[model samples]
Target: MTTVAEAASWARDLEALAIRISPRFCRLEARERARRYLAGLLAPLERKNGWQLAEAAGDASPDSVQDFLARMRWDADAVRDDLRAYVVEHLGDPDAVLVLDEIGFLKKGERSVGVQRQYSGTAGRIENCQIGVFLSYAGRHGYALIDRTLYLPQPWAGDEERRRTAWVPETVAFATKPKLGLTMLERALDAGVPCGWVAGDSVYGTDSAIRRTLERRRVGYVLTVTSGQRLWPGTVSDWVEEVPADGWHRLSAGDGAKGPRLYDWARLPFRGAPEGWSKALLIRRRLGDGELTFYLTCAPEGTALADLVWVAGARWTIESAFEMAKGEVGLDQYEVRSWTGWHRHITLAVLAFAFLTVLRKAAIKGRGPSRLGGRLDPADRARDSTPASPPPASADSRHLRRYRLVILAKTSSAESKAIALEAPYQNR
Candidate 1:
């Protein structure tokens, strides 16, 4: 485990990086204000006396943190673009897989955008919540968030009063998560990000529009599909000729001996399929666990088998990213009610997580201790030649020192002064 000092140092380093990425982040009334907001979320620090977590983070007052976030230009789109550029410049490999996924935030009330009695993947049951569609860039260098969209419920978008109350823009409209995901892909491609192929789950795979869009853009995709999804074996002409005048037939296949019957199989191009549909492979696999699944892809006609398998497997990275962000990095722990607060909190959480990820990778590669964890290591202290005594200790003394080092190294005398303007909220 990392020492307290080391953890605090890491937090400071993360704050500095956040400032560098968006200087406006540091300009928020107090310097440590933003740092405290992030540290409280990232570290397992206990709440301070007389300060509620929300109040301490500046979310209580009128000109509060929520308002600040609402007025800022650090919206989802801008943040996504900045992070995308960062990943490309610092993390991208020549061959990288762009992973797209949507995570649903289970909200309790119906007022928030897209909060309906619907299925939330997060809760694994029907619940009221906002769903966020996200796109991520993942490869050996590191993973960085690329895009996100708040799925507005039809009621919120269709009602002018509710829309105004939520501060949702007039142009905001209802669109399925998959549709929003497609827009994210288009934006990334328009920016000239070097993405080789796209990978997603059955939700995206089942959407003919998404698959066709990829085909239209000449982008390769490896997407999972339901066993019932139609596919044309060999060629389109073959399927067209085989279908009777009454269209296609759904064949019944047995799940087991004297067992439940299900669709055996069939591959056909989408009905009324548009032109430019690339020749894609239809594949099925029987896992060692006895689960059967299918996938569709257009990974060049004769690509090596190994390369095809690798592309198909890349989608798991996004899942891992989501798991780490929510579980380890506290992605869903914000207690805000406003849309702006939610967005800002999630963005900051993403940045904090990304910084830690970069640091961990650097540490593993023997690049030295992370700037956020201070320049010292517990292991290093063990090797010191000074006469040994009972090791220095405090509940949070180690972390406090590391945090101080990071702040000192990243914030200059002038920046420190600017940060100090917020006074009492500096550090507690």
Candidate 2:
């Protein structure tokens, strides 16, 4: 249950956020309406479309909200920059992981911007939908989606009539999902969004350019790749067959809803790492059927295998954020079809999601078990052949449970230049 004081604090936080972005809106009326729009996004309405949101704001019609989203002269990109700054202010950590992934918004019509028959993770199959490439910040305290790009399909990009009808900007061009993810990553790093590692699934991991860019910038990463991904002389699957049974170490990547996600793990150095940097193949095997998953890890030399596992686990943080944003904050409950309208609504939803995350972090602080960090008990370590490192002393040890993977995985930009990198995959 929400306490009155806590609710009041959330209100004030919302107001503060409104004031922070007020300058983006040229007109005072538009500024006020944006605030109401934000409030409506946070409201517990069944649908977050223009009608429902305006009704919740005590308006006779959705004209105000719709106008704010479509014709309102505010720059959505500017508001997004504010969202990024806000996330950093509250949840910034040096060990934070910047995660990139895409979600599909299922739409019925062909007129929606970027709508086409494509594979959407939301539906788990090819569907007519708009794909959104998103970047989320996952810090020790909490996580939130901070940046986004709508993937304009090649056909839509080439169709001038459709593009003009949807009010797509001339400056926008057809870019692969990985390229868009790369652009967002570059933007965040340029804006000084503090993070030590990057995590993504194969959509990003398969793009060698993305990996090279991170390497040049000296950022660590744990990106997933397919078993068939070649590593010089042989494929990853081929190398897996050479590993002795004793080479595998049982480890918990991180805690999930059910509990610690334990899997058999093995790591081996890969050739062709630049001088001072280390590259390795980290493989995970399911306990039940020995199913295999591979990760390409890049990090500073001497990065522990446990730390790579921790970073690999961090990729799921974005998935949970997507679920929360859509289920609680109406991230997908938009009725917009135009490019500007889509951006405006999504930006506001992102704001509302960030607000809820901050409130939840405050509500749970010092009250319950830490969500990500757990102390590994001796008995848990006893399952592995080699004894793990001594657990760090934590004030929350009383709240810490067994089988939790605990490590900072902190890497400096300077240190990252000489580190090995890892990779993971997005849900296809």
Best by lDDT: 2
Per-candidate TM-score against the hidden true structure: 0.68, 0.86
RMSD of each: 18.1, 9.4
For residue 152, what is the lDDT in candidate 1?
Answer: 79
Candidate 2, residues 63-148: lDDT per residue as tens digits? Answer: 88878889979999999999999888767666678999999999998999999999998799999999999999986668999999
Model 1, span 276-354: residue lDDT tens: 3234443422322324455676544333333334455557667667777786556766555555666666776676667
For model 2 the local lDDT of residue 313 reads: 84
lDDT of 1: 0.56
Off by over 4 Å in 2: 366-428
TM-score of decoy 2: 0.86
Model 2: residue 69 alpha-carbon error in angstroms: 0.7
